[model samples]
Target: MSDCYELFLTCPKSLEGLLVEEATQLGLQEVREQVAVVRGQGDLETAYRLCLWSRLANRVLLVLARFPVQNAEDLYQGVLAVDWHDHLMSSGSLAVEFSGHGSGIDNTHFGALKVKDAVVDKLRTADGVRPSIDKVNPDLRIHLRLEKGEAILSLDLAGHSLHQRGYRLQQGAAPLKENLAAAILIRAGWPRIAAEGGALADPMCGVGTFLVEAAMMAADMAPNLKRERWGFSNWLGHVPALWKKLHEEARARADAGLAKPPLWIRGYEGDPRLIQPGRNNIERAGLGDWVKIYQGELATFEPRPDQNQKGLVVSNPPYGERLGDEASLLYLYQNLGERLRQACLGWEAAVFTGAPELGKRMGIRSHKQYAFWNGALACKLLLLKVLPEQFVTGERRAAGDESRSAPQNEPARLSEGGQMFANRLQKNLKQLGKWARKEGIQCYRLYDADMPEYALAIDLYGDRVHVQEYAPPRSIDPEKAQARLLDALAAIPQALDVDPANVVVKRRERQSGTRQYERQGSEGRFLEVVEGGVKLLVNLTDYLDTGLFLDHRPMRMRIQREAAGKRFLNLFCYTATASVHAAKGGARSTTSVDLSKTYLDWARRNLSLNGFSDKHKLQQGDVMAWLAEDRGEYDMIFIDPPTFSNSKRMEGVFDVQRDQVQLLDLAMARLAPGGVLYFSNNFRKFELDEGLAARYAVTEISAETIDPDFARNTKIHRAWRLATR
Candidate 1:
């Protein structure tokens, strides 16, 4: 045994650099960083200090030996060569943790077993006394790594992982590890902020991990001071006197730090269930006076510290793992951004998230980004300075002019072609505004590619405008198309007398498979618009199409008109706008079917918004499969499926042209006697199978379904009414 020991400090991936820096600061010499592991040289006291204070390390390993091994026997011999009496008592319990593979030991469990056998065999006495295996509460924890035919054996100086600071016994569904949370706080410059008497807040503080970690850091508390056990506790080389001195020093530093004025640290969670738990965690960290937890929603999360004090707004908002989780989370992130802008101006923000794309929807720019890992999921810590300049107004300036910000009171001037586009928009609005007000319609198409050069479909949803730019053909120069788009966007706000921030833009191209249904953005901004005396929810920014299909206005009205006292069915429901109409029109019952859980969830919200949840049922599955299994009959059925769909949830690709006959037959089977089946699709080349007309009385209602708004595009979609002969 020597006074100096070669040590390996292990941390979560992406924190090796930070660990190296911290270890070096803690007097570790010659520190070298590898992937997830930092190698350095330190004395026994330095190792102990790191176990107590190092915020980023998972384990501190004191290297005992390094030897080459070609097979399992070689590994056994190598372990046996170590003098067991120097480290562990013969009767003491131990645990063996082995990592890596090769040298004929491919399985980690087998490798660990072999190491344990060698250690126990070497320690056995003449009377057969030997160490027993204790996985938990082990007196000695040995770690072995087989790398490139060499075994590196070390003693785990930290008993359990250093991340278990002993405060967070209870956590949320996706609680960040203590060490990782500390790392995030450090990266967010909490130390600097705290030293300046600044405050800290987390709007979505589940279990108060960030709040506790920040308080501990600010109070200069040793992270593992309260940990009851350590791997070196029972080791023969343990130096009690030196350890006692270091522990007392840490305690004194914590006491002195606590004597200073406490920083304003608070956390707010939307879930009331987590509020008490978060307070418990804060109390466990001995920070009850310095921190408080409250039950509050993200929409109303405003952190009020002492007067004139600004700090950091840190949070790990849920980045959903499920398919449709992002859609709902978008608004959460957006709301978070909005709160920061409204309440925390001039303060700093650090949002740690697994979904960086969702972070972009926050409508703010992060000045810096740090990559980290939460277990296996790669994550990012976005650092933002919440200033007015960092706010995104949702308006994209033209290329080469992105740096210039438009004045708040003045609108951007339109180009010559933009003026023409603006005039056309004004003409259409004047013509349609009269009709819209006369009919009491709050949502309708104001412009639909009226000028081909500025190929756009602009719809007015209440006061906001939803603009969809038709992707230019290959023959047109992309730059020209982009210029035209900018022109149209600029003219829209002024031409329609709407705020620029109220416009949402998306590019519309020929979509294949389920691309059309996929989310184009995640702002999750939904607007309620009235049509036919019923309120419907429409998300202007999330999907390629708003939840409400404006072209289907007439058809939905028709459904509402004939729905009185009738059982109605909506196929490929798509947010169930028509079903809501049916429910409002006094339908006996309404069943809406769609394969997309996202849309079904939206449909549920739509139904709930209109107070029609009980009688209107929303089913999630392939429409065809659902129709086949359904045994109920309906007086009126509407089938408005996508032009083509290759959704993975379905058994096979659905070509509306190829599968119409089978689809109609399956749907018509559930249609009651004299029931009307209204079928529609947008495929321009689609031709109804002639055989269907012979079997049932079919009438083309395309003309009747086309409203004045979509009159210019009569072929936008074709509809037909089919009934039994």
Candidate 2:
């Protein structure tokens, strides 16, 4: 073996800078970074030092030979040229790891087999014995990389990758890789913080990877000290005496470092199953006394009074893969931001996430951001110094004329496409402003898909703006959609002259069954606005549907005008906004029926807000079931069912399109002799069946219900009036 040789240190992508810095610090010369590999010149002892101390390296490969080869025969010949007997004994087992493919070596498995065959054939010819292939635990590990007819053969001195530090016996779901975790700590400046005796925390720690790594760094403990198996153990090229001396020195240093006073390293996890694994990992790393993990939710994680007040809080929360409902996760992000602002006053916050759109929900300004990869998924690491000046402009401002805050989340320098959207919003607002002002409407739709490229519905609820983006089709490029969304968000604050904090955004897609009624979050924050002279509470963040339906404003107003001295019935009366208007119109009595208890509670609050107490009634049950059981007659009725429902309380699935006839017949049976029933639905493709229209006097009133705010989108909903002949 040569005294000095070429060493290739492999680490996770985006961490090459840290590894280069580390190698340079360790006295390795000519260190250069390329993707995930760092090339350097070092002696055997320098390689040994890296294997023992590198917290960021996945493997240390010693380059043995390089050649130009093509096809399996050429590859076999090239690998055979290396003197195999000098590395390992002929009787020992070996493992070959092949990466990349070119010039007829199209697959990794085939290329690795060729290299293995060549090595075995050479050893057999030299010593009359062949080394057996051992994939699980090999005596010698070989690495081969082929690219564009060029081959580089190397010996993997670190087996099973240096990342397998032997501390993590169990793992939680989506555990951050150990090396990547170390890279995050290094990038977040944990070394400086540790030197100053400041604290470190991972609120969403998975199996204590960050906690263990942080403690190891603070105490100067070698990362691979606890590992039992290594490729160099049985290699003939390894110097036994030198390795022994280095190993002993590492053990002594680790022991002394472990004895230092702990720098507060703590973690918090909501999952109880993850807590034990985190504790177990810390203990296995010989850091039981230095690192601690407790069970807690993200919203309630706060630094203890006994702990360091100013430090860093870093976490890897879920990235929202879009397979299931994401409403709760949005609230999770929003609440996380709120908690960080409330509790972590002077600390630093670092959040790593794969879904950058979900990151926008946090509402906190990131002063610095770095891009990294978790396997194949592209991710972002956002860093923010939690202080008043660092907060996103207009994040928590309370004012009437809130002049445009900084572009929502630092939008890309105003593009011409963004300027076009700004002009469209201004035109729509001016067109609707006179009508809205004359009618005394405090809440109205300002723009509705006015531009096809920007598929959004912008609504004004007094001072707050609610933006709903329709999910784009699969054929659209994701980056393009994201750019368009950012452009639209950037244009909103400037066009409407409102604060960005007052803007709440949500993605709207076709709902499956009862998912539309599912709770997105529980912020419990409400804004009271007037619609047709009735006071109602609207929540923009908690659920998919705001409490009041702006499209049905004209219908609610008509109910108020026509229900004088008449008994009124509101079916599927979500929040009872229409029923409140009826009560204000001197209805003899009003009854509201719905299947959700939450909406029933909201309905009660709305009635209480308007001083209409005993005469108005709220019924919580399946509206169809309630209609079938009701025996009383009413002079006026409104039946508006959801497009589809699979609620557990319902006897069976309910589809408005398929069951409208039976539903109308049931309501007609309960109608007084001269009473009228109004039916409405939001199914865009709904067509009224002809048989029911022939049986009764049915009038399509969809056009009459279109108000000025919703006139641009004529297909918003369809309405009908029916009465017995």
Using all chains and alpha carbons, the TM-scores for the candidates as numbered come to 0.71, 0.65
What lDDT does each candidate get? Answer: 0.88, 0.84
Clashes of each: 0, 0
User: Distance (Å) between predicted and true CA of 240, model 2?
Assistant: 2.7
TM-score of 1: 0.71
| Model 1, span 1-725: residue lDDT tens | 89999999999999988888889988899999999999999898899999999999999999999999999999999999999999999999999999999999999999999999999999999999999999998999999999999999999999899999999988998899998999999999999999888999999999999998999999999999888788889999999999999999999999998888889999989888888888888888888988899999987787888786789999999966542343346546666776776677778999999977667657678999999999889999999987767777434334333222333332334568978999999999999899889989899999999888988888899998887878889999976776577567657777888765577777788999989789966778788878898888888877888888899899999999999999999999999999999998999999999999999999998888888887888888998888889999999999999988888899988999999999999988999998999999889999999999988899999999988899899998999999998
**How high is the lDDT of residue 291 in model 2?**
89
Cα lDDT, model 2, residue 658: 96
Q: What's the true lDDT of residue 264 in model 1? A: 96
